[model samples]
Target: MFAIVRRHPANIAWIALNVALLIVVAGLLVAGSRVSVTGYYSEAAWNWMAGQSMYDTTGTGFLYLPHSAIAYIPFAVQAHPQGDVAWRIISLILFVLGCYRFFRLSPQKSEFFNLSAGFVALLLCADCMRNGQATVIMTATMLLAIDAIRRENWHLCTWLLMLGFAVKPLSIVLILLVGALYAPMRWRLGVGIIVLALVPFAFQSPDYVWQQYEEFGLCLFHSNRIGYEKWWAQLFGMLKAFGLEVPDSIQTASRLLCAVGTLAICFVLKQKLDSKRFLVWLYTLTAIYLMLFNPRTENCTYCVLGPALGLFYAEALCGRRWFAAGSMMALAVVILGSFELGQHITPQGVPPVWLAPLACCFFTLYAAFRLTSELNRLEPPPSREAQPVLE
Candidate 1:
């Protein structure tokens, strides 16, 4: 086990690189996350500070929870010194903790490695630090749950999932889908989720909580698709161009098809996927999650594309993939999702007419192909050996 950890070039390189990225990009992300505390989260946060009822702030443009905002207590409309400091502190903690969980999820020998270098890797990936929000909390808690699963510590996994859900509902999907896919971790984690989820309601003012939930649901489905062009529109739009009349039905089916196809490819490949392959899978899944299940996502949501870039670079170094496509798209995201893009404010609605669904189609297909092969790489011991391990 120690030899394996020693063999991790990723960790050794990260020890040096991670600190630099955190000081640079992570710093930027933290600032970005806090910038427009204006939308729903801001409104609710400000209102809550005023000792008024806290209702759904989604319409105000806060898709995820105002984790730091909430903790700051009492509305952000009038800033207090302690409140501001508290917000920064929370963001820092979430950022560091998130880095820890992610590293632990990687190859590690001891719990100590899980605690230190794994976190360093996370900080190394620290792309979303400045504009951190509930997503920070979401990523941190949920990844911890995932790490716990890898450790076979269901008790801790449950607590992490609960912590994640309390920050953002969608985060629960990480715990649910991944845990279920890796089924053995189910029992304790699932129970922890249920209890943690329900326990919150007990203390939260019913009216306050219900109003927020109502707003979340309403804003969720009722929202317009006008933000950025739906990434899936490319394939569907191409089919439409041929007069095939692709509808939401086709959209749903396509996503399912992608999932099944990716899984099958992984199963068939049956090899340990290098990081680049993992990137392809991450991109494929993220693309589907955002385009199909996201219901409402915007340019800003592209922050996650960093992980894809990381994987792509890792793979490229291995002479596996060309850097052009990932590079260009990543540049596009950095340009669009960045603070600089806020000034443009062009009422560009969804169906991102400019996305050239053709581009999207090719990108999606390539990613799916990559991910499937990666999955096939993960090997399990034969049944006889597996039984003893399970026991």
Candidate 2:
């Protein structure tokens, strides 16, 4: 192990940094610092274990499906501080492994690229880790799922995607989008969803499970209704920052159109790009959409974009695309420094909520241009017979 570490010094340093962070976060938790949203998750799990309702009307209420609470049971059962620290450790390990796998997906890799991109991604998502947000696991699962797709491991892909959904229902966007566009995933995803939905029934009484499902639906509906009435750190907030107060009807219409448009783009790219490129692009597009369009998107939610940005940055550097590398670096810095930058530009340093959406907009436009250029350069396949079989 020491010899291997000496051979890959940069990777070892990255690993060391993650270990240091884990220790710092653990110490903070033990010191009674309220650094995580794990309390809400623990409360929901406790409520479920007590055969009580997990849903509430508060802003910080548990908004995930019934299975999510069940999934949190392991951590929830552990005592405070220790439980929180353990959750963070597991999350960080998964996140680091996921990022490493994503970096491997690149056509070329080097010590500099790995170290630089890894550090940048960690910096971009540090707050989310510190806050013990489930988004960290969601992001990690999504990265792993994409890697699974690249390898055509359908079963693993299905399981990883389902795990992400079980952690945060918001992952349904990626689930449905990928299922619809990837032919091999369609049936596997169908089975996975069915199994996931039924798993709770085995753990609880049928009536209780059904009742929780109903409450889950109601909770989602209430959250959506509230999401519309309030401005979140998404596209609408970005627009509001620019003094463009779009009407609710228009916002609703725009969301529908954009969702459809995203599917359309993915469909086209599926036919033209290789499986690996397609999967990577698919993940990037999904992450951007979630940040830009998800109704309840918060500043910490921007962590979803960290893996994709890190991969892109590394790819740009390897390919000698300085402009792309700079753009990605700037976006990551903007997101990581949004609080400090906002103080000078916005009132009371209210961490410009618009910064993330703005970065997503630029990324989307650039990605579109790059995709269009690549598509135009490729010769059309003969009779669609040359396409690789994903299964």
Q: What's the CA RMSD for each of the models?
A: 9.3, 6.3
Compare the candidates by lDDT and give the number of the best one: 2
Error of 1 at 178 (Å): 2.3
lDDT of 2 at 59: 37
* Cα lDDT for residue 140, candidate 2: 90
Q: Which runs of model 2 end up more than 4 angstroms from their true locations?
A: 1-6, 348-351, 379-391
Which candidate should be chosen as best, given TM-score against the real structure?
2
Model 2 / residue 161 / CA error / Å:
1.0
lDDT of every predicted structure (CA atoms): 0.46, 0.83
lDDT of 1 by residue, 20-65 (tens): 5445543543455444343445566665555454543334355544
Q: Write the per-residue lDDT of candidate 2 for residues 283-381, one digit (tens) a residue.
A: 888988898888888878888888888888777877899999999889888888765676578755243777777887887887787778878888666
Tell me the deviation in Å of residue 140 in model 2: 1.2
Which residue runs of candidate 1 sit more than 4 Å off their true CA positions? 1-35, 38-42, 49-51, 56-58, 62-132, 187-190, 224-288, 291-293, 318-366, 369-391
- The residue pairs found clashing in candidate 2 are none
Kindly give the number of clashing pairs for every candidate: 30, 0
